[model samples]
Target: MATITSASLPRPATRGEAKLFAEFRAFWRAFVAKAFNPYRPELHYMRGPGPAWRAKHVGLSPAVQSMLAEIRTGKARRSSPSA
Candidate 1:
């Protein structure tokens, strides 16, 4: 580690230096907001893996939905009453 000394420290800032520092800070804030940020679109519904996986299976055909409902009610009907 480097040793710290009083002589290595920066001199106190004058009024002009202080004003320039403030202006640079303001410019950086505005610049980063427009240029350095990622583009994230808004989602009206749930996001991420769980929601995505659930959504894929949740959209079932009418026939499939009816079959599922019947199975749940202990009345699953096999087409043609297989032998």
Candidate 2:
């Protein structure tokens, strides 16, 4: 086995080098956090209905379609009985 020498050993970093390393570490951490972010807005968002839904609902009657349109447009009032 070869003997370990002082010259071959790793030296302690100076204050400036330590500060630079810390800054680099912080920057790398932030970069990784942003790059590997798990929160996907598109995945969680509601995109209304898809083509399959539209195809399935294509046979809706005109009266039902009109009622749905009214409800969607907020023109259909609640038919609650007055107390």
In lDDT terms, which candidate is top? 2
Clashing pairs in 1: none
Please report, in order, the local distance difference test score of every candidate based on alpha carbons.
Answer: 0.79, 0.87
lDDT of 2 by residue, 2-24 (tens): 99766666899999999999999
Q: Which candidate gets the maximum TM-score versus the true structure? A: 2
- Clash counts for all predictions: 0, 0
**Which portions of model 1 miss their true places by more than 4 Å?**
1-8, 37-83
Q: Mind giving the per-residue lDDT tens digits that candidate 1 earns over 1-83?
A: 99977766788999999999999999999999978667755544545569768778778889999998888766545444657
Q: Among all windows of ten consecutive residues in candidate 1, which has the lowest summed lDDT?
A: 40-49
